[model samples]
Each structure stands twice: as structure tokens, then as C-alpha cells.
Target: MNDSADYCDDFYNYVCGGFVNSTLIPDDKNSVNIFITLNDKVTKQLNTIISRPSQPDEPEIFKLAKSLYKICMDTNAIEEQGVKPLFDYVEQLGGWPVLKKDNEWDESLFNWKENIAQILENKFWVTGFFGFYQTIDIKNNTRRVIGLSDYNAGLARKNLIKGLEDKSVLNYFNYMVNMSVALGAEQEHAEEELKEALEFEIKLTNLTRPDEDYRDQTLAYNPMTLGDLAKRYPYFEWKKYFNYELSPSNISVDNDEIIIVSNPDYFDKLDELIDSTPKKTQANLLIWKEIRSLSGFLNKNIREVNGNYAKIRTGIIKGTPRWMKCTNTVSSTFSIATNALYVREYFKKESKDNVAVMIKNIHNQFIKLLNSTSWLDEETRINAIKKAEKINQFVAYPDELLNNSIINDYHKAFENFEMIGDSYLESSSNLDFFGNKIGWSELREKNVPNMWDSFATRSSTANAFYSSSENSIMLPAGILQGEFFNNELPKYMNYGAIGGVVGHEIMHAFDDQGKQYDADGNVFDWWSNSTNEQYKKKAQCIIDQYGNYTVKEINMNINGINTQGENIADNGGIKAVYLAYNDWSSNNELEKKLPGFNFNSRQMFWVAYANTWCSKSRLESQKLRLIYDNHSPSEFRVNGPLSNIEEFSTDFGCPIGSKMNPEKKCTIW
Candidate 1:
């Protein structure tokens, strides 16, 4: 504890000051927090599993994952081959115009529209001008449909809007120039052509909307027939593009078929830009995107150039070690296999059972909180309870992970993919095609509701998620270890740490966004108009409360509208879990006090909760997150939630109007 600061004044500092003051952010990372520190342990465990020599008797998925890791780790092969593999890949894409001298390029040969469809079919993963993928139809969550939206830009919309004035945008331009030049383009020519490409990207970004602007799902969800879409935005031939992209999966699209255009205006704006901009500039941007996406996977020189851009983007002084990079890539790309391997080697059944029990207790506490909330009408209150009861809890790894048949079926898309181990670039390209092929293939199959296959893409990570489409909360095996949970820790500490996370995820079902989805996970309104108004009023209090908190380092207040859902979850989570912990303590015998502290069990609980968010971050990362991240900074995450809970003030004996004991506290669950 920091004796200099009082607990009531700054709960986060009092609890986390010692660690934050003493610890340094790792050179390879932009921030160091409890979550990041614990994740390092999980990565080390995965590295041990993936680095083992491949076994002949292992499952095909296991062998494939191991082989992919082996290929990524072979720096000698990558360095020797140099950029030749990438240049060859580019030749197949009808050539990057910037690579050729001005007059030598044949613009007639390169059709950006046809090239886009070809890349989508062959590469399957990289999204250039537009994005097309399967998503759960919001109104009918029982099935998936193709959703089209604007491209995921190289720079974020927020940064791109700043034009060349933004340092990140400037760095991106430099990265583009340097990368094209490395591929044998003349420096001056590459810069001149790529400058137009960069400007085209900025123009495209302006046409698209920011994520914060689309919080109201109705504004974003526009279901249109393929025929209608073709008639409305005729510049790019939507019908032909869809047919070409989906033909590889043997899924045909007719004129009457329905697809969700998430951003309808984007197509209109895009058509205008397509008509005005030169085809050469558009082609350069398209290929530049491909180059940017594959740069990190190329030779050492290309990777160094890529790493330099990352340093500016994330504020890291050094690049991550190669083994760690390869490990993370393998884990994400082969998530199902990684989950199976992680569970078989490390996770215990007892931990799963224990977390399940905690989830049940916290869930019951939330229902009780809803029952007693005076602001909610009786009908709304009852429906809220039913929704809470219906929430599915997926604790630790799914049972399907233990079955080889299911694992193999999940990996059937990669049936044709083989790793030659001679070239990482070729292997990576094939993996991208096969891996992303699964998402496109889903369009052919009706989504089986409440199945683990749809949502278990990432189970071996140190995180928790509440999926609105599934109406479920997933507590992955990765989060069950380290500081988050322990078998031998006191019930209070365990309840305070992981229990808070469990409660937070549960509360999300009633947050601004999640509340829109009903118990069936359909986008239906279950609340009465009167009750809805009351809920909004309560939410506004939270919005205003968090909006006032300024991150002094950045001189910017928190984007309360952007982060309201998370703040609500954080507050409601701690509140429900604390009461649940009290009930458990009352029934069971109170555990003996610890050796170092004189505080009671309740006080220790709050300290443990705060400790989970203990962190130190670089200024650059902090600025970036403040602008984009939905969650508040680590310090605010602790203090912001605690300050609003009267239970915390009473336990700490904080005065009625101290910083931690505000006169007005916002509570909405």
C-alpha cells in the first residue's frame, strides 16, 4: 500500500501505486498491466506447446498448427529468399503500377474491380476496397448473411481525417514509399505514384463513418436485394462482384437474394470517387494494401520496414522477439487447435467447475438487483430477470474441444492446404486463403443456434466476451490462470478478481447495445416505452459522470458516449459481485486474516479488484486508446467504478462528498 495517499481520495493509487511506481513498461510493449503481465505467462505456455517437434501420430489440425509455427520461425529461409516471393505474388495481382516506370505500365491490362474479386477468391483474408463477410442477421439471429461495409483502412478513420498533419498518416506514407522502393521501384517515381494512392485512401476514409457514429444499429443495418443494390450503385457491379467472390465456395447469388449493406451511403460515395479518380491511382492503392498486409510476413528487410511503422503506431522502442510473434500468430490463426492443445496440456477441470459456480452466484445476484431496482416497471423488470436467467455461460474450454472429430470438422476448410516448409510466405498465403474460406463457406450453411462452433474461434486468450448474437458469455481457459483466478486463493480474493469480470460480462446483456437484443438474441425491443425512457435517464447520468473525467496526460475527457457500455458494465459488475461475496461470507465461515494487512475481508476484496487494473502505459499508447478504445484508461477503470458505489465509500469510511464518495452516484444495471 502507498501510505502517502488516502484510500478514500484515490482508491486506485492507494492500491496500485506501489506496482505502477516500481514497474516499467516493457521495451517491446506499449503498456504493462496485470492483464498484459498474465498474458505473457499464457504466451510462454503456448510457446512451449507449439515449439515441440511435430508428432506423426498427432491429429491433422495439431500437425498443421505446429507446421505453420515452424515455417514462421524459419528466419534463415525467409532471409535467403528475400522479396522475390512477394514480387512474384504481386505479378499475379496484375502488377503494382508504381513498380514500373511511368510509360511501361499497361493500364488497360489492370482492372481494379476484377483484381479485387480475384484477390478475395484467392487470398480470402485481406480486405482492400470493400469488405464482404458473413455476420449474424441482427433481426433473425438464427442464420448468417453476407454483410458489406467500407474497407478496413491502413490508418484509422480518425487519423485519416487528420490528413497528412497526423504523424501516423505521414509514417504510413513513408512506409509505403520505402516498401515499394525495396521491391525495386525507383524512389522518386514510387513516391509520386504512392502519394496519389495515399490521398485516395484519405478521400475514401471520409466517405465512411466512424464506429462511434453507428451505435444505433438501425442506422447501420440496411438489408437490400442484390438486384436493388446493382441498380442503386452501378459503378462497381455488385451482382457480378458477389458472384465472382462466392463462386469458389460454390455459393451462387441470384438477383432476389438479400444481403445487408451496413453502410449504404458508402457505396453511393464510393461510386462518385470511382468515377472521378484515375484508375491508376486506385490500382496503386489496391496493391499498396496487399503489400502492406504481407510486408510483415516477408523478408527481414521488409519486416524491419514494417516494424518501424509499428513503433510509431504503438510507441514501442523495440520489436517483439520472433518466437513470440510466431506463437501469437499461430494461436490466433489456429485458435480451435490452440484451445484444444491448451486445455489438454494446462487447464484443469476443477478450475472450470469453480468458475461455473462463481458465474451462477453472480448471475443470481444480478437478477436480485434487477428485482429490487425501483426505476424499472414490473413488466420490464420481469423480462430483465428472464433474460438474465436465459444467459448461457461457457466456462473455460468448451467440451467439444476434447473431441477430435469436431476439431477435424472445424478445420475441414484447410483440407487442401499444405505447408512445404520451404517458404513461409507461400505457406502463410495458403493458410490465409484456407482459414478465411471458413467464414465465406458459412454463407452456404444455416447457422445452428446456440452452437459453440460459431463463437469459439478464440478460446485460448486471456479475455472474456459477451456475444450478443449468441446471448452467451465465454470465459476462455486462458483467463482462468494467473492473477485472474487461483484454486487456493481465499474466496473473497477470487470473487473479487475473476468474479468482477464475470459480473461485468453479465451486465453487458443490459447495456445500451446489448439491451437491444432480446433473450432470443434477436434485435427486438422488450422494454416498454416508459421503462425505456427511465433506463435512458439512468444511462445519461453515467454518461455525464464519466464524460467529466479528464485524462490529464492527454488533456482530453473520456468519450463517455463511446465508452458508456463498458463503464456501466464495470460499475454493475463490481456492485453485484461485492454483494454476492458478502452473502457467501455470511453463509460460510469467514476466512482467517492475512499476514500483512489489518483490513477486513471486504477491504481486501476491493484491493484485489483494484489490483487487477494496475498498469503503466506509454504516453503515445494512452493518446491512441483515449481516442479509439471503448474502455476507459486503467486508472479510471478502477476509480471510476468504485467512486460511484456507496458500498465502497461505506467500507472505506469515506466522507459523503470526498472524491471517492460523490454526492451523486450513478447506478444502472
Candidate 2:
């Protein structure tokens, strides 16, 4: 605590100022926060698991994961190969035009759609020209559908639209040229051709919807058959492309198969861009996307060039350590096995039961708040409470993870996939296809009942998530450690930290985005029209409130529109958890206070909450996050929510008009 600082003026500073001022951001890290600290701990634990030599009786999945890590860590193997693997990959794509002499390249021999379909078939890189994947149909959570949308380019739409004048765009263009030359293209020719390709991407950016348009589910839910898609936008051969793309899974799609096209307007505009652009330039851009995607996996020279671009984007003084990078890669690639290993070795069984109890208490508190909220009409209130009651809470690891049969069945896809001990690039390339095989295998199947396992093998991640499609919240075992929770901690401390996290996820079910989904996770409007209007009116106040606050380091204000969902969750979460704690404490005996603390348990509750967000970040990273991150800066996350809760000011005895106790406060829940 900063004893000299006043709680009323700025509670974040009062609690976290001393720590934030004293801590230095690590050279390799862009920012240091409670979440990052916990993630690093998880990574280190994974390192310990993978670093040990494989036991004779170890599971095949574990052996495979360790092998992947070994290949990544063997820097000598990568350096000696030196761009040959990438050069061979380009040749497999029927050659990049920039790499060819003017007469050596034949335009008639190049078929852009064939190149794209082959890339999609291998699943080496996803975004180029456009993107397609299978996800749960939002309108029908029981089934999955093929989703099509505009290309997620190498650069964001905002940066790409800025043209070469923007430093970020210029850096990207330079990266393309340097990488192409490294792959044996002539420098002057590479630059000239890539410039045209860069312009083509800029045109591509204009075809997509604005970033905010994607927030609403209804705008993106255009369902059509493959036949209809081809008829509507005849420039690309949709049916032929998908038939080849889905061949690996042996699942063929007829023209009548229903597909979800998220950005219908993008396809309408895309036909024009394709007609005006040259096939050669289009080929250059497509192959360049491949080069960009695989650069980090290649030699040190390629990674260093890519690293320079990353330094400009993220503001880190050094790259991540090799072991750390390899550890994370293995964790992602073999998520289920790694998650199983983490739970068996480190997670305590009691934490799950303890956190579940807290979840129930916080859930009941949310129902109470919904019942009392006057802005909601009777029907809206009933529907809101029903949704809250039905929410699926997944605490820690899944029960299925303990079953060896299930783990083995999940990893059976890798049995036939070949991997060389020393050839990291070929191994990585093969893994991409196998990874897509797992994904494409999900097409047209019922949603998995064990939702935690169905997600991107992230049960080992030190983060929590609210999935609106499933109408569920996942509290992975990885996040239930360190400052978040422990079996021995006081209930008040747990409620203030992890308990708040539980409430936050529950609030997401009613936030701007999650509210669109009904209790069954279908995208249906269950609220009364008048109540919906009232909800928006309240939401606007929060938007205006947060938009006014500025980050001094970056001279930028928070994107209130972009971050409103998280802000709503943060504000409502604190209220629910605080009330839940009060109710429990009143029923039980008063908890003992912490040693050396000059405050009661209630005051300590606020302190624990504030300390959870104590962090220091590089200014360059802060600037980028301020523009792109969906949540507010850490300081704002702490101060912004505490200031809105009346109990906080009362506990701290703040003056009514002070910064932490502003007369006009925004509340949505």
C-alpha cells in the first residue's frame, strides 16, 4: 500500500502505485501483470514436464509432444538447413513469380484458385484472398457449419488501409521484400512486384466490414448453399475449391450443402478486386502470405528479420528464450496431453470443489441483482435469470481427462502422421495438415458435450473465458493457482479475486455481445423491445464514461466502443462478488485480518482486488494495446470498476465527490 496516497482521489494508485513504480518490465516481455506472471509460472511448469527424458512406459502423446519441443530447441539443426525448406515449399506452390526472371515465369501456367485450394488443403496457412472454417452454427448450437468470411490479412484492416505512408505498412512491405530475397528472389524485382502486391492487399482491406460490425452476431449470419455462393459471386470456383479442401477428411460437400457466409458484402466487392488485379500479382501476394506465416519456424536470419518487425510492433528488447518458445509451441500443438500432464502433476483436486462453491454463490448473487434491476421489463428479467441459471460452469480440468482411453482416442489422429527427429520444418508442415484434419473432422457433427476439451486444447492456459455460443464459462485448472485461489486461503480473499472472475464471466452472458444469445445459446432476441432500448441507453453511458479517460503515456483514450463488453463485465462482476462476500461473511464468523495490515477484512478485500492488477508495461506496447486490446489498460481495469461500486467508497470512507466516489456513476447490471 502507498500509505501517503489518498484512496478517494485514485484508489488504483493508493493500492498499486508503490509496486507499479518499483517494478520494471522485463527486457523480453512487453508487459508484466498478474495474468502474465501466472502464465509464465504455467509455462515454466510445462518446461519442467517436457525437459525430462521420456520414461520407457510414457504415453505416446507425451513422447510426441517432447519430440516436437526437442526439434524446436535444436537451433543447430535449423541454422544448418538455412532456407532450403522454405525454398522447397515455394517450389511446391508452383513457384513465386518474383523469384522468376521476367521470361522464366509463365502467366498461363499459374492458376490462383488452384494455388489457394492447395494451400487450404495442406492447412499450412489459413488467411489469403478469403478464409473458411467450421464452427458451431450460432442459430443452432447443436450443429456446426462451414463459415466463410473476408481475408484476415497479414496486417489489420486499419493499418493496411493507411497505405505505405504508415510506418507499420512500410515495415510490412519491407518484410515481404527481404523475405522474398532471402528465398532467392532478385532484390529490385522483388521490391517492384511486392509493391503491387501490397497495393492489392490494401484494396482487399476495403472490401471487408469495419471491425465493429463483427461484434453483432446477426450481421454476420448469412446462410447459403455452396451453389448459391457460386452463383452470387462467380469470380471464384467455390464448389471445386471446397471439394479439394475437404478431401483430406474424405468429406465431400455437394452444392446444396448449407454454408454460413459472414461477410456477404465482402464477396460482392471481391469479384471486382479479382477482375482488376493481375494473376501474377495475386500469386505473389498469396505465396507471400505463406512466407510470412512460416518465417519464424525457419532459420535465424529469417527469424531475426521477422523479429525486427515484431520489435517495432510490440516494443520488446529481446526475443523470447528458445526453451520458452518451444515449450509454448508444444503446449499448443499437443494441448490435451499437456493439459492432462499439468492436472495430474500440479493441480489439487480440492481447488475445483472450492471454486465451484464460489461459482454457485456468485451465480445466486447475479440472479438477485437481475431480479432487482428496474430497467429490465418482467419478461426480460425472467429470461435473464433463466440464462444465468442455465449457464454451464467448467471448473479446473475436465473429468474426461483422467480417462486414458479418452486421451488416446483424442490423439489417435497423429498415429499415422510422420515426423522427423531433426527436421523441424517438415514436422511443423505435417502437423498443420493433421491439425486441420482434427478441425475439419468436426464438420456437421453434434457439438461435443465436454466443451472444455472441444476448445483449442487450452485447458492448460492461465486464463478464463465466457463462450456465448455454448452459454458457458471455462475456469481452466491452469488459472486456479497463484493469487487467484487456494484451498487454504480465506473466503473473503478468494471471493475478491477468483470469485470476482466467476462473476465477470457470468456477467458476460448478459454483456453487449453475450446478451444476443438466449439460454440455449441460440442467437435470438429474448428481451422486450422497450427493455432492449433501455439496455442500450444504459450501455451508452458506460461508453461515454470510459471514452473520456486518457492514458497519459500514449496520449490516447480508450476505445469505449471496442471495450464496452469487458467493461460491463468488470463493473457488474465487482458488485456481484462484493455482495456475495457480504452475504457469506454475515452468515459466518468474522475472518481474521492479515498481519501488518492496518485494515479490516472488508478493506483487505479491496486491497487484494487492487493488487491483482498491479502491473508495468512498455510505452510502445501500451500504445498498441490502447488501439487494439479489447480490455482497458490494467490501471483503468482496477480504478474504473472500484470507483463505480458504492460499497468501495463506504468501506474506504471516501468523500462523495472524490474521484473514487464520483456523484454520477455508470451501472448496467
Candidate 3:
């Protein structure tokens, strides 16, 4: 029998010598190679797990155990040494919950104003380090200019204060700052702890050197099981322990009673509009429109603001700068560009039919899932499904906004570039003064078409997101590739990975935050009081569950208040994906089995789903994410959901009363 310490040493050796050797390559110019290597290792491990049989051997389990063991070792090492100071400081300041409860604690009311002082000090530090402003050459149609850094700083500061006016937003900022400080401190501590743990573990074990392959030996020794891995590593064990009591219940499987409104024609018309236009012309039109839009805004405000510059500057410095970019073209242009690129590429693909099929299926699945929710009242469920069905699926991209004539027209309209810049600034001031009187129609008419080119270049990103305000889910071409989606791979893999991602995005419409918006993307109380209360109760359960997990020696504090929306989205996404898969399965689709893998197509689906999220983060990045990001760590995302999912447990034959299977599970939509 192997001693626990010996096991630890061997695991350490595998991580440093075998795993790192296999994944990481040293290069002088690129310091981030270690992170990349770790990411690759995680991806490879997930793939292996996915390919494993339903009843994996001790070897398979041990491999997973070893990987997780190393992860815990690395994480704990950082938490104890690097992040402890910040954690302690934040704890002393009052944990998030406590600080949040003190709503009436105003800086002016306090004797010393500790909270306000800390915030001001941190703001100064940030301004000093990052430098605050940028200047743009309004006349030359170029970004080059002086005073831009100050300008940008002023704008950033203004935005920050505006955000702070809302108590929730202010708290979020405070949380981010506190968390950032904590993460930075914790990273140093964790690194030192990891080095020491590695050294100690290495001294105890006999293993092959870093240069050699360990596949033969890995095959010889049966890898640790999940149970064994959790027991041996307290860090990993703690997550499972907490999850046992906190994991939310599975969503109901019956999705038949829901009303699904189908709009298979939305994308078709959008495609026809784009296909009729020439690509180069469309691209040129987009650029021309963007340039003109910027010029138009700058033309109006440059002079008016010049007169009030000192007063505006004072207000800005005092944390009360007015919103000056109500008529700004940058954000709108960016949205247009991103949307256009998405639309163009989508139409170009041979799988237009496939895209349509996916959208229709997503719509139908959401309707069914909403109707099946036992907790939601009939009226709420009906409205929720209506919202889901009403959601407009914009595929590929929007139609070209600029024609040659329109571009030329806008170009001629901006004869004096400097005046145009001043006019642009004036327009912003006017919008700020008037408030929503500028109207969406007038703004749309002035909008340009340059976003397509920008988006086409940035097409390789690996994620997709939903916008509650827009009631849209963007499926970029970048994430449409890889393990997530490939035309050649088996349907099960595609559905499990990419399809799962799509379903997840669709479900966001009904997640805690998204549900706040109605079908038309308006914020309104669409649910009954009883239903709303039930929803809150269910959401709170998820918050409590995730809040209990810790990262880097500090409790994650889950900010259930803040992250409840995202957690709900995640839970719903998984369920939506599963239901979408079932819908596909019912069509008598044939399952293809991979060679050397014991799992059938159904089992492989879950494995593929889990594999998509196998990733690692730097301690700093991880800490930042815990504070600012809505999603949980990737590990928790997989394990947390899998534990709640009976299907996953059943597929793996997870033992009853195992850490993964608790007696009570909290269920929500």
C-alpha cells in the first residue's frame, strides 16, 4: 500500500516532471508559457476523462485524483502565503455581507470615514499607476492627440462615480477593489507555498525525471478515484463537502406542457438582406459611417465644453461628472461592427440550415423547460415562455447599414473636420441636457457601418454571451470552432459542447437577472408576487450553495446577492442543453462510438460537456474573477453542476451518499 505522503510526492512529481514536461515549453520571450501549458494539460485531462468508459478503472480515477491533487496543492500554497494578508484585511473591514448590510454608513456621518478614505486612497493609487486620460485628434480623423490621457481619466472617473450612485454598483466597485488587493497579496503567498509543497513532495517520491514520458508507468499504476482524491486532498475534499449540502436540485425533466413560439423566418430575412449587398461595398460603407458618426459628435461639443471646461473639470474631480457621451458613436459603432461580422460569416457558412435548426430547437426547448417548472405559477410561466419565444435570434450579422450613396452623403456633410468635431461634442452635451429626446430613429439614421471589419478580425475568441437589454444571444464564429463545434465530429460531441453553450446562452433570458427584463427587453414586474418570491427563494438556495465554497484560504463569500443571476443562468443553461440534446435524440439520430472509449454516445455527451470548461487561471486572475466575474471557477462550474445533475451521477455510477450525491438538493429553474 502506498503511504499518503508517498502518494503526494508521486503526484507532485507527475505534476512537475510529467505533466508540466508534456505541456509546457520554456521560452525566454514569453513568460506566460507556464499558464498556457497548464491550460493544455487541463484540456487533455478533460478529453481523457470524456473518452473513458462509464465504469472507469482505478487508473483513470487515480489520474483524475492526481491532477486534482496538484491543483489543490498549487491553489492552497498560493492562498496561504500570497493572499492571506488581503483576506485578513477584508475580513477585518467586514466580510462582504456585513459591509453590504451597513447601507446607512455614510462617510460624512462617520468620525474618520474609514471606508471612504480607503476608497479615495485606492482611487489615487489606480490613477497614479494607470494614468487617467487620452486625447483624440478631432480635426485629423486620427486617434493622435494631446490631453487624451487626462480626458480619458476624467471620463473614467466620472463613469465610476455615476456607477457608485447606485448602492449596488458602489458595493460592486468596493468589492472589486478589496478583492483585487486580496488576490495580489494571495498570489505571492500561494506561489511560495506551492514551491515548498513541491520540494517536500519531491523529496519523498521516486519517479522518472522531467524529460521522460510517464505513460507506461501511468498505465501500470491505477490512478486515484474521485473519493480517494478528495479524501487525500483536503482542498478538493472541502469543495465536495460543502457542495453535498448546497448543490441545487435538478430541473424537472418534463418539458411537454410548455408553449413554444417558433420564428424560423427571422434569420432568413436577415440573410437575404445581407446577401443582396456586395461585401467590399458593405465593408467600406461600415467604415465611412463610423468615421462620420464620430466626426458629427465631436463637431458639436468641443466649443460648449471648452467654456465650461473648468467647472466640468471641478465636477468631474469631485466625483460628479455629467454623462457627456449620450450621443457617442464608439459603442454603437462597435455593436454594429460585431453584429455585422457575426451575420456575414453566419450567412457565408454552408451550415445555414444547421444554424436555423439550432435556433428553432433552442426556442422550442426553452418554452418546454419554462412550462415544466413546478415552482413558477401558470401566469408567470406563460409570460416567461412568451418572453423566450419573443426573443429575436439574430444570426451571423445584421444587414449592411451603409450604402455608397449614404457614405458619400455623410462624407460631404462633414466638410469642416474641426467644426464637425465640435458639433459632435455639442451633440453629446445636447443629449445629456435633453435626456432621451434625441430618439432612437434619428440616432439610427446617423449610424455608420464600420463594425463588420473590426469584428471579422476578432473572430477567434472562444466564448459567447447573452445581453438582457438586447434580448439576444451572440454566437461568434470563433467559439463555433474547436471541440465546441466541428462539422466533422459526431453529433453527440457537437451537441454536448457547442450546442450546450448555445442552450446556456438561451437560458440566460430567464436567469435571475435576465428574468427582470420583459419580452421586449423592458424592465418590469412581469411575474406575480408569489412567483417572484418563489423565484427569489430558489435563487437564494444557489447563492448559499456557491457562497460556502472558498478560494485561496478565504471563503468565496459567493456574493450570492451579486452572483445569483449568473448562477441561475449556469444552472438553467445545463438543463437547457440537456433538454436540447434529448430533443435531438428523439429524432432517431444514430450514435457513433469512439474507438478505445467504453462510453456510449449518451455518456460521451456529458463528458464532452464537462471537457469544454476544463481550464486553469493565474492566482491573480482567479482572485479577480471571484470578485468581479459572475461565473464560478471552471472547476466548480463542472463539479458543481455535475453533482446536482442526477443524469451525470447515474452515468458515472456515483455511489449513493457519496460526496457528489447528497441527501438533499436545492432545485430551481
Candidate 4:
């Protein structure tokens, strides 16, 4: 695998190749080519249905067909179900016309509000729903520890204990719980099947590296990771503490230095600028404030429950998982844990330099990619390049922020576990009910930085995102290694796998959602109405097209209406990366093709792009996603976009009118 050709094969076989084969459903010569030849007809029918107003006595068959079509095209069944349920729920709560009867709230509406609140509360518990609450629980020897999970979970448990305090909400919760329980019972069979699939991935990883140690390997880092670690040590969940370290370093402002300021003054400045910020940026900031407030409240609650703060602290430290310790030894929280794990597992130390170099090289390539975009206006392009240049790259760990006294001070402030827990719930509930007044002042404060540093720790994390509010892109340390990046892989493979990801984050600055924010990371609309309209029209075409797809056997409809922004980003990111790759090839005088692959780098680029999104999900999960998630499923993500991209068809030699090559195309950026 060290040689370029071997590296390419390893990459093609292990990473990008799997996606190409898995997602591109081969056309059956004997079967009717419904998708290939009748896309227009199907699309037209879907459009007609979408345009029509609700009518009583509509054909049941039409409803079923439309539902099935939605399930297939959209890759989300849950969302499809949500369409009718949400509409019904809203209407039942009070028809939209009735709710909108008054511009302002009426005292009579209090019943409606109370009903809605009860329903929301009930939904929380059954669905692991949580809301803010204050409670104290005794631990061994009269000590206490604060426990915080999803607010919904707490709320649901409380509702159960209180015997369904609100009848309307209680009934809803009961119905949902019964359905979920029944679903769980039915799903037991499917779980067996899925276990094999999951185990297969694990086995593949194990088989591929038989010589490597497996005892210490961990699943991807997430909030779930904390849960997993807590199973081994019920006394404490160390993932929380580790998160405290990782999140702050993840903050970036327009690719500049990763600044984690807790100064009240900074919060004040941010408040002053909020009105001037773009809507999306403001929305994201508000959301972050909500999340942070929740986090703080959770910490406070745990402290209040535990009488001995030191014991609670010990539990947190001792609960640090072995894998996290190995990954983040430099940090005080994980240093002892890492040493203990190393000794326990007898694992050899790997060079941090290798990981650092990979990150640096990828970061540099992304910068170069940003320099090559032809679509951006010169002024925008120059600023984009400067932003790329300014981006501070922190690979694998925090710099020196760990030593800040704020970390210690935060620990000291939580002198009582029960009070901390109560404070957490109160703070979170207040934030939710009253809006972001705390955020306004907190942003101005320069006392301590917010955000956890676990994002920089080693472990596997599949997710990545660009924070418009922070003006930064975060690649968790866990995702930096593995199939996404390896020094041994060919540049094409790297670009297609991790390189495409880097490009994706970089291009996010210009995505429909991200573009709302300016270079400074403040949200403000800068596009002319004409340009914005043009983009929206193009985006709508994609929505309509995607809305027409169906999942076999399910009566579902994908909501292209909801998923438009993500679709735009997917299409635009692929284009930007491909262009960037071409620029790199031309400037560096690299070989036009990898040995043995017999494809030009340009062709490989699209293939790589397709491969990154290869995934399989349970039908139930798929259904759930349609209702909630913004992105389309993996199969549609590959097939839908590829069919629309002329470049992809040209490379694959997909004849016109083929499933992969449609006569009509939709383009938006």
C-alpha cells in the first residue's frame, strides 16, 4: 500500500469504491426502465398534486400513490408522515385560520397554548422529551451527582411519574408510546438483520488490520460516546468533562484564529451587531446560545445534587474512557486516563506528527481549492482566499487554552451538586421561555470561553460542520484519520475522500445557507434580489425533482421543499472541489491519471465525491429522517445529483435518457 498504485487500489477498494458500487443501482435489462424514461411524466404528476389545495374526497389511491412517491424520492419516510401529522396537529390545536385570527394573543387562546404545551411536554417524555427542571437526588453516603441527558427524556419521565398531568398531552403521549413500543417489538426481528450488517463493518475493519490492536479501539466520538463510557463506570460520565475541553478550540471566525472568548464585553458587542447580522447567522447564534445555556444548566444541576463537590469531580475524572485518554493525553482531564489505558492495552505510541502533517496538507489543499473557484465574483473570490489564508489550523489538540484559569474557576463555582442541577434547569428553562437575554450579556463578557474541546480529541466522528456564527469550520479530531485520510493514499483518492470533505467545508461559506453570513461571520444579506431570486428558482427545480422519488414498498413522499438547502450545498460543493482539483493538476504538472485506474483525475474527482456519501440506513431510521433531517438519503444523494450533473454523465459515458443521464437538468448554486 505504500506505492502510489497500491495506495490507489487500497483506496478504491476500501473507501470510495464501496460507495460507487453500493449506491449506483444497476439497471436491469429485462425490467421496465421506469426511472429512466418516465422521470418527466412522474415529475409533472407530482407537481400537479403539490400545487393543488387540499380537497375532501380526494381519491385514496392518489393519496397512497403520492405518499409512496414521496417515500421513494425523498429518502425520508418520517418526514413524509410528519407532513400530514403536523398539518393535522396544527389544525386540531386550532385551524391556522383560527390561530391567525388575531395578530396578537387573546386570553381565550390561553387554553390553546396550554393544550399545545401539554402536548409538547407529553411528546417529550415518550420520545425521550425533556424540558428544564430542577431536582436533587441523594447518592451514596448522602452525596449527589448531577445527571443531564436530553431534556425530553427528563420531561417524559416526569410526566410518567405524575400520571399524565395534562389529559390531551397525556393521551398523545400514550398513543405515541404505545406505537413506539409496538414498533420496537416488531423491530426486534429487523434488529437481528441489522446486527449482521453492523458487525460486518466491524469485522471488515478488524480483518483489514489483523495485526493492529483492537482491545483499545472505540466507536466514533459523540454524545453517544459519553453514554457508552458511562455504562462501564456508572459513577460518572467523563465525556462531559472532555467535551468541555474540545468544543472551544473548534470555534473559528472566517478561517481566522480559533478564539474562545468568555468576556461579557464581547457578548455585548455581538448583541449590538445582532440586528445588523444576517437572519441565518442570527438564527444559528441564537441556537448556540440555547445549547450553551442548556450545557451550563446541566453542569449546575449535577453540582447541586452532590454534597461533596470533590467526589463528583473525581467521578467525572475517573469516568474518562480509555480511548479518549489515549487520544487526548496532553489535556489535564485525559492525561492520567490515557496513561492508564496505554498500560492496560499494551498499545504502542503512534507519532502525532503524522496526524498533524495530514491535517496541514489537507488544510493547504483546501486553501488552494478556495483560490481556484471561478464562479465567485473577483471581490468575493479575493476575500474568500484571504479568509482561507487566515483560517487557523489546530490539528488533533488544543494549544494552551487548557491552562486558562476559567476551567478551574468553572469547577470551583459548582460547590453544590443539587444547586448546580437546579440552576441548570432554571437557566435553560428561562432561556427557552424568555429568549436570549442571557446570551446578549454573556457574549459581551470576557470572563471565560465557552465550547468543549472534545471535538479536537482522537476518536472517530463522522460529522463535520461550518459554523457561520463563529465564522469557522470544525473537523473533529476523530474524523481526521481512517478512511477519510491516510498518507499512503493517492492524491485523487485523498481529494475524493477527505479532500472533498475539506472542499465541502470550505465551499460551505458560499452555500445558500452559509452565504447569508458575511466574511466577518456576521449574518447579513449581501446578494442582490435578482441573484437571490435566480438561485431560489434553480433551487426549487431541484426540490420538485427530488420530491418525485419513492422508496419501494413504503407510502412516502420526500419533501424536496425542506431539503433544498442541503441539496444546493451538495451540488455546489462537488462542483467547487472538482474545479479546485483541475487547478491543482494544471499548476503542479502532476500525472493526468493514476496508474491502473485508467481514468483521468477529473473523472476520479466525481467518483470520489459520490463515494464519500455512501451509506445504508434502516428503513425505520430512513422514515424518521424524512420527517426531520435536512439532507437526502445516501442513494438519492448519489443518484439524484449525478443524474443532473452533465460532467458525471460525460465521465461515465451514461447515454442520454439513461437513469444516470436525463434529458433535463437542474442547476443552482
Candidate 4 C-alpha lDDT tens digits along 517-568: 5555544566666656665677778888889977543566777766766776
Candidate 2 worst ten-residue window by lDDT: 117-126
Runs with alpha carbons beyond 4 Å of true place in candidate 1: 116-127, 412-416, 454-456
Model 1 agreement with the true structure over 1-669: per-residue lDDT tens digits: 677889999999998889878988879999998688778888999999989988887778888889889989989989998887777767766689998877877788666666642322264323377888778899998677888888678877888879789887888899899888888889999889999999999999888888887777777789999899889987777777777667766778999988899888888888678779997898899888888878878888888888888788789999999999999999888888887888888889999999998899999999999988988998888888889899998988778888888888877766666785568877777676665556676686777666876446666779898988778998888899888899999888898899989999998999989999888788888999999998899889989988999988768788889999999999998999999999889999988776798889999899989988988888889888987799999888899999999999999999999999989888886
Model 2's lDDT to the true fold?
0.85
lDDT of each: 0.84, 0.85, 0.43, 0.40
Q: Model 1, residue 96: displacement in angstroms? A: 2.2
> lDDT, candidate 3, residue 556?
44
Q: Candidates 3 and 4: which is better by lDDT? A: 3
The residue-by-residue lDDT of candidate 2 on 1-669, one tens digit each, is: 687888889888888899888888888999998899999999999999988888877778888898898899989999998888777777766678998998887777666666632322254432377888887888988887898988788876777899999877898899899888877888999999999999998889888877778778899999999999999988788887787778878788998989899889888888778878998898899888888888888899889988877787789989888899999999988888888888889888998898998898889999999999989899889899999999998888888777778787878877666566587887887787788777887785788544647543767788898989888888998899999987787887888888878888999999999999999889999999999999899889889888898999879899888899999999999899988998999999999987788788898888888888888888878877876789998888888988888999999999899999999999988
In candidate 3, which residue ranges exceed 4 Å CA deviation? Answer: 1-348, 399-461, 552-557
TM-score of each: 0.96, 0.96, 0.48, 0.45
Clashes of 1: 0
Per-candidate count of clashing residue pairs (backbone under 3 Å)? 0, 0, 51, 79
Please provide the root mean square deviation of candidate 1 (C-alpha atoms, Å): 2.0
Better of 2 and 4 by lDDT: 2
